[model samples]
Target: MVVTNIAFIPARGGSKRLPRKNILPFLGKPIIGHTVLAALQTQLFDRVVVSTEDTEIAAVVSQWDVEVDQRSHALAGDSVSVVEVCLDFLDRTYKNRLPDTMVVLYATAPLRRAEDIQSVMNLLDEDCHFAMAVSVCHWPVHQVLKNHGDHVVPVFPELIHSKRSQWDRYYLDNGSTYAVHVDAFQREKTFYGHRLKIHEMPRARSIDIDTVEDFEWARYQAERMLL
Candidate 1:
């Protein structure tokens, strides 16, 4: 089916890495504000809904110019997979009136720019299983090492002997944005199913907020961008 309307944004309340990081105050508003603003800026989807079980978070989202898909408590646990959250949100919010497309935007991705969102949306097609934002990292895979029991092994052993980083280039899942067809998600819960599309964004714009340090870094980056 051809895709037009999309609705989905996973923002659970609990976070072991950085407790309540999703609703944490950023520069002037909650962390999710940036994501909501970016989503609105794109003006691509018919409706943008934030999926969460927390009333406070839902209240904050209501303050924004978008709808809220108040999630169930069981689905809000840390153990819940993002795919599960997205599926549930879609089922409950739209019922049988599912959209042709569904895009899942993570609230932790504060640095995801409005332009990048628009760029990824442009890549969405009926044939595409999924499409997401990706960015190239400065580090080489050869530099990564892993501890294997008693021995430290090269994360990518083959890359250890590689001459140039360019020849062994790798892209990181920026976690900034994702757009998927509704039918594709029903078939495969993952964004990268059988046929996935890639939309590259600037590495600086893909800063996913996780810790206090990450928040500070995002602030610094945002300030820098403003200047």
Candidate 2:
């Protein structure tokens, strides 16, 4: 079998809201472990590399069969972009031999499916600059509030009249995972460029772990699915 040429999991250790969030226990395993296990289960990529600046994260990742690229503090700062970490890792380790494409798997997305990963990989093509897994949602974007100098006001007055939920267009950006060609990513440093594509995932698989409450809910969802 010819495995795809790219794969990477980025887990920085400086989350402020949820300290040590990467290694936090979820579904009887560390949060990062879930992403690692899912990526390994796909068996689609030629290589899987974990990028982190924390030695403890490195130690935990080392237990897996995947390679661990120790990131520097400069690149791992709270202000540094994910693109820098990715580009730095590739530049330092792989040198001129970067992969044809790469998948940026979020460690917080423990509910991500192996099929979701494979689905994005399957959708990759020369025309597509990037493809990311997304779940359609009906967020009340129009009902959102904006603060004026003294008073908060509705962002969209037209939505105040539109009472029906069906009228709203479907929204994206569940923030679970994104797949991009390494070459295109280097050009823009963003996934949603002119030629980006979407690989639709089920809403059940789009649970992103942002807060403690989200973590518990994800665990419950996983347990229910297991049963």
Residue ranges of candidate 2 with Cα displaced over 4 Å: 1-4, 163-168
What is candidate 1's lDDT per residue for 88-143, written digit by digit as tens? Answer: 77666565556877777889988887888877777876666688899986676676
Look at candidate 1 and give me any clashing residue pairs.
none
lDDT of 2 at 105: 89
Reference-based TM-score of each model:
0.91, 0.90
What is candidate 2's lDDT per residue for 1-227, written digit by digit as tens? 33346678888888877788899977777889988988999987788888888888888878787888788878887888777888777677665556788898888889888888988877779888688888876566667789999999888876766766546556587777788888778888787866777888767667888788887788888888892
Best by TM-score: 1
The whole-model lDDT of each prediction reads 0.80, 0.80
The predictions' CA RMSDs to the true structure, in order, are 2.4, 2.4
Return the TM-score for candidate 2, rounded to 2 decimals.
Answer: 0.90
